[model samples]
Structures are given as structure tokens and as C-alpha cells.
Target: MTDPIYAIPDIHGQDALLDEALERVARDGGPQATIVFLGDLVDRGPDSRAVIERLMQGQAEGRPWRVLRGNHDQMLLDFLDRSVIHSPRVASGLSWLNPRLGGAETLASYGVTAPDPEAAHAEARAAVPQAHRDWLARLPLWHEAGPLLFVHAGLRPGVALDRQDPDDLMWIRAGFLDHAEPHPWLVVHGHTALDHPAHFGTRIDLDGGAGFGRPLWPAVFEGRGCWLLTDSGREPLTPAE
Candidate 1:
């Protein structure tokens, strides 16, 4: 079989599910497979710590794995890199949603917890080690392979692939999939969750939304085509205190 590109979506601290998906992808696509993660590895899952550790291990081993930061990923990294967020939206909506989705579970994995919600959020913010912060900061906005353009979010329609802003690649929807204007490449991404992974013209969205209690989507790319190999099962995170 041709060495294929396997792209995984969401994650949401579902380390066991991630392992299962990875195993399935490895079995179906072989060890030579190139893997790209669509981000959101932490929050609202049982094993965020394990997931981060495994990803680091894979990278250290030179495995063909790359990651595109999701909105959640960017926020988490920012919670680490920045001392405080000036935007109240981030301090509130983003903060609460993250734990509600699985950020707390990720913290639990590290054998740490805050005395209170405020403390917890701060702790999570401080938990990101500098090394990890640097790594996250340096992640690419998009990864290109032949006809596929992989990003955390789809590039805005009418914007040439070469002209996509890095921030937009990580967070855009209406502007990205305007659909009125034709796009330059077949955009593959995982930010806007779907009831199912579907293709709309040159775009394929694979964020089946693991944090929303759905499957962890893994797409196998071969011969210019993509197919999802998912664990469409439930994996609950610990209930909040």
C-alpha cells in the first residue's frame, strides 16, 4: 500500500480513544504513515496528560506526525504563554467551555488541581511548561501534501492558499467556507464540528467533535482521496467538582 497520510481530529483528552484510533490507523495504513493532528488534545477527556506525553514521544522518535493548532490548542498555549488575557471573552467563554469540555481532566492527569475554579484556571494556565509553550507557538498554520491543504480551520474562500493568514487558518469558518467564491485547494480541517464528516466541494471537515461526546475522527488519505477511520464511541471525562 502507498504510504498514506492519516489525519486525526479533536482528541479532547480522550487518550484511550486516541490510542485506539492511532492503533487502527497504524494497522490500516502501516508504520510508514504520516500523521497530522487537527489539535484540541486537551480538555473534557480522561487522559490529556497521557495524550500530550505520547505526542511528544512520537515527535521525539521522529514519527511522521505533525500538528495544526486548533482554537482550543491556541487558547491553551496562550493561557501558558501569556500571563493574562485582556479579552474578557477568552477569560470567560473560552475558559469555562474548555474545562466543561475537558481542560480540568487534562489538569487532573498531571496530578494537580486548583483549590478553586479560579485557582484551577490559573493552575492550568501555569501548568504548560515553557518547552511545550515554545513547541506549540511554533506549530504551522497549514500542512500541504499534493492536493490536500490541512489546517485547524479551513482557509477563507477566495483567499489563495499562499495568502491565508496564520491566525485565520487556526480560526475561521463563515469567511473560510463562503462557498460563493471558489477556493484554490481542497481544504481539510477540524474546527467546526459536524454531525458527520462530509465534503463540500474542495473542503472535507473531519471534526466529528469528540468533546461533544462524539467520535474521534481519523482520516486516511490515499491516492488523492480521504476516508475516515473513527472510534465513534463515547468516552466520558471526570465530572467537574
Candidate 2:
């Protein structure tokens, strides 16, 4: 039999909640289980640095973990790169560093406190560890497990997986969300915020608005089914039914 897979949704800098979720996974799936973090590890809440640090430690310890890159995660990378800010893909004058997008909070998590965006960007760049930045930059946009395709966001319907745009993989919404047809694989994602995990048979959305004051929804997938890991134990996820 295959080892159980734990699917953790967007953390959004809530390290305490992440701790609880991982503990629950360990209790239920044991220490040898595979854990896949569905991205959005930084921004919004407090302690994004703590979240990243913990994951880095886990990686260093050689734990069974896979980290995907979320749009917010890419935004941080873009901010650090600087050149991307002027690209046409981004809004003409919008700054990813704006608090509305949670970049400021991420910077704050790294001990950067500045009166302006420019100062904050410089401090954040200087404060963030090279290792952490390197890890974040190297994160894969998606991970495949048998029939399941795990990504930070939904995939564009009808497009070949290899040909799918990287931006769409991390940031697409309406086009991917509204599609009713099934893809070649079960797309497990965490980008669009929902009150609970929205399991649509063909696709499963694990983003439970944890970045906006909701509980993080960590799940387990085995064979052809999935279950939500709670304090009480595993509850079969049937959001579509």
C-alpha cells in the first residue's frame, strides 16, 4: 500500500495553527507519512518567518515534505527581484509590498519595520536569510502523486499540464474555478478562499480562509478518497455531495 499523504492548505503565516495541523497529521498518519504543503506559506498573519523557518528545519532534517509555490509566495519573490514590478503582468502602479496584499506583514515577520515601502523592501531583502529565499525560489509549482496533481491553485481546463502557464498555476482563479469539466488528474489546490474545503469530485480546494481568520484545513488522501483531519479524528470530506 502507498504511504498516506497529508495535504496541508495555505498557512498564511499562522505557525501555531500549522503546528497543530502537523501534530494532528503525525498522530493520525504517523511519522513516516508524506506531507505536502499547498503553499501560501507567507503573508497576512503574524510569523511568516516562523512558518518558513520551521519548514526549512523540517527540510534540513530530511522529513517527507513537499512545498509548492503560491501566488503570495511568488509576490515576495517578485518584490525581491524588483524587475518584475514593471512587467505587464502586474498592475501598472500597484505595489506587491502593500499591506493589502500582505507583503508588509511578511516583511514585518522578518523583523523589518520601515515607515515606507522602499525602506521596508530594503530591510526585508536584507533581513531575509539567503537560505530561506533560495528555498522559496526553488519551490515547485506543482507536485504529482499517482492520479492526483497537487498545485497551489487550480489548473486551466483543457490545457496540457506541461503547457500550462506558470502564472496561471499560481494565480489563476475564475477561469480555473468556473470550469465544470474534469482534467486528466484530480487537482488538489489551495488558493481560492472558502469557509471549508470545497471538494468538487474532480477538484479539491483546501484553502479555508486561514489567511483571513479561519482554521487551516489539513487533509489526508489515500487511494481514491480524501479525509479531513480534525481533533476528533479523520472525517471523510464530501463537500460536493
Candidate 3:
């Protein structure tokens, strides 16, 4: 029998929720299970640092955890490395540190203050350790396992998986979300922030809007089927019959 694969989506700095989700995974899948985090590990919650650090420690301790890069994670990197006010793929004037995306909350997790937003760049650089930055930068854009492809966001329709743009992988919403056709693999992804994990016939969106006070639901995949790894137990997930 194939080992079950576990996936968590869009933590968004809710470390407590993350802990609960992981505990459930461990209970169901045990300590040796492989977990794929669907990105947006930072921003919008109270403890981005705690979330990142926990994941980092787990990976360092030889846990089979795969982390993907989210658009918001890219925003923090852009600010620290390029001093950009916002992500180039995003709107012209939208700063990452803006209250909406919760970059300020992320910075606060590192003990850096974003009083003026612009002026907090140097402080953020100093306060956030280089190891953490390196880990974030090194996060892969996607992870493919068997017939499932785990990515931060849905892929662009009609584009070959290898040919898909990195920006589209992390930030896309338009064509990818609306497209009804099935791709080569089951695109398991987050970033859309739905109220619940939605399993379209062609794909599964596991992002339960943990960034917006929703639960950080983890999912288990076995062969072609999926289930919600809730506190009570595994609940089979599928498109409406």
C-alpha cells in the first residue's frame, strides 16, 4: 500500500493553529509521515517567526517536511533583498508591510517594528536572522509526488507544468482558478483562502483561510482520494455527487 501524504495550506502566522494541525497529522500519520506545507507561512497572524522556526527545526531534525514559497513570503524577501516597496508582480503602490497583508505582523514576530513601513527595512534585516532568510529563499516553488503536484497557488491553464511561470505558481488567480479543465496531475494548492477546503473535480484547494481566522485544515491523500484531517478523525473529501 502507498503511504498517505499529508498537506497543510497557508498557515499565515497562526502558530497555534499550525500546532494543532501538526498534532492531528502526527496522531493519524505518525512521526515519519511526509508533510507538505502549501506556503504563506508568514504574515497576517501573531507569530510568523514561531511558525517559520518550528518548521525549520522540524526539517533540521530530519522530519520529512516540504515547504513551498508563497507570494507573501516572496514579498518579505523582496523587501529585505531588493528594498522594493511591493512585489513587482503586484500593484504599483501596495507595500508588503501594509496592514492588509500583515507584513507588519510578520516583522513584529521577529521583534522588528514597522512604524513607518519604509523605515523598518534596515531593522527587519538586522532582526531577522540570515538562516531564516536563507531558508525562505531556498524554498522550492513546487513539490511533485506521484499524481499530485503541491504548489502555493494553482497553475495557469493550458501551460505545461514545467513551462508555468514562477509568479503564476505563487500569485496567480485569474485563469488558473476559473479553468474547469483537468491538468496532468492533481494540483494540490492554496492561496485562494476559501472558507473550506474545496475539492473541484480536477483539483483540490486546501487553503482554509487560516490567515483570516479560519482553521488551518490539513489533508491526507491516498491514491486518488483525499480526506480532511480534522480533530475528530479523517473525513472523506470529494466533489459534490
Candidate 4:
């Protein structure tokens, strides 16, 4: 039998939940199975630093996994850079490290106290280890396997994959979420919060609002369909019958 591809949606600094979800994946797919992390690894929840450390350790130990970048992750990097003031698109006017966007929580996870935004940014840049920053910098925006496309966010409709803007890939919502047209390949994405996984025929949204006190939904895909890899067992996912 072919090994299934497992996807873990937005973690949002919840290391404990992430550990639980990963344990479920291991039980179902074993050590050799392919795993993809659909980004937003930091911000909002506690222990964002530890979350990145765990993933980095996995990569070091030779785990077959891919970590895609989300808007939140990009925000953290932009905040650290010092050269960049604001996010290019969706979060344009907002400072990349604005506390309102969960930057304070993430910075605190790395041992930087956010008494003031500017001061916190400097402290965070100094506190975060270079290795962690390198890993974050190298995270890819997308990954493809068979007919599926794994991304942090949905793709814009009618745009070819190569021509799709990086801004859309990291920050788009309305146009990408509302469109019903089939994509070139089935897209698996996170970023948008949902009470449960939303499985459109052409895409699957695995963001279960883990950042908002919901469960982290990890799933496995084989052929053209998917199943939620829950603590109990595998539950098939399909959009309303």
C-alpha cells in the first residue's frame, strides 16, 4: 500500500496540542510516512519558541516533513528583520510586530518582554536563536504531492500557479475562499478558522482554529480524498455528503 500524506494544520504556538496531534499521526502512519505542516507555527498561544524548537529537532532527526510558511510566521520574521516596517499586503498598515497581531505573545515565548513595541522587537531579535531564524527564513510557501497542493493559505482563482502572487499565497482570503471553481490541483490549506475542517471538492481547509481554543485538526490524504486523524482514530472528511 502507498504511504499516506499527513498534514498538520496551523499550530499557533500550542506545543502541547501539536505534540498530541503528532503522536496521533505517528500511530497511524508510522515514522516513515510523509508529513506536511501547514504553517502558522507561532503567535497567539504560549510556547511559540518551543514549538519551533520541536519542529527543528524533527528535521534534524531526519523526519520526512515539510514546513510551509503562513502570514503569522512571516510577520515574526519581518518583525525581527528591523529593515521591514509593515507587511506588504493584507496587513499593510499594521506593523509586522504589532502586539494586536499576537506578536507580543510570540516575543514573550522567546523570552522577550513587550513593555514597548519597538523595544520588544529589538529584544526579540536578540533573544531568538539564529538557528531558529534560519529555519523560519527557509520555510517554503507551498509543497506538492501527487495531485495535491499544500499551502498556508488558499490560492487566488483563475491565476496559474507560477503567476500567483506571493502576497495572495500568504494573505488572501475573500477571493480565494469564496470562489467555487476547481483549481489546477486540489489545494490543502490553513489560515482561515473553522469550527471543523471544510472539505471543498477542489480544496480542504484544515484550520480548526487552534489559535482560538479549538482542536488542531491533523489529516491524512490518499488518492483524491482525506480523513481526519483524530485521537480516537481516522474519520473520513467530506463536504456535506
Best by TM-score: 3
Q: What are the RMSDs of all candidates, in order?
A: 6.6, 2.0, 1.3, 1.8
**Model 4 worst lDDT window (10 residues):** 83-92
Q: Which ranges in model 4 have alpha carbons more than 4 Å from their true place?
A: 83-100
Local error of candidate 1 at residue 128 (angstroms): 3.5
RMSD of 1: 6.6
Better of 1 and 4 by TM-score: 4
Compared with the true structure, the alpha-carbon lDDT of candidate 4 equals 0.86
Model 2, 138: alpha-carbon shift in Å?
A: 0.4
The TM-scores, one per candidate, come to 0.82, 0.94, 0.96, 0.93
Instruction: Provide the overall lDDT of each model, using Cα atoms, as 2-decimal numbers.
Output: 0.71, 0.86, 0.91, 0.86
Off by over 4 Å in 2: 83-94
Compared with the true structure, what per-residue lDDT tens digits does model 4 show for residues 46-137?
A: 98999999999998999998999898998888878763546657444876455446677888898888676778867877899988888999
Model 2's lDDT to the true fold? 0.86
What is candidate 2's lDDT per residue for 1-241, written digit by digit as tens?
7767889999999999999999999999887669999999998889899999999899889899999999888888887767243334445455656555677788888888785767776777789988888999999999999988999987889888889999999988878888888788888999889998878878999899999989998999996589999999999986555
Worst 10 residues of 1 by lDDT: 232-241
Q: Which one wins by TM-score: 3 or 4?
A: 3
Q: Residue by residue across 106-183, what tens digits does model 3's lDDT show?
A: 999988885875578889889999999999999999999988999999888888878989999999988988888888
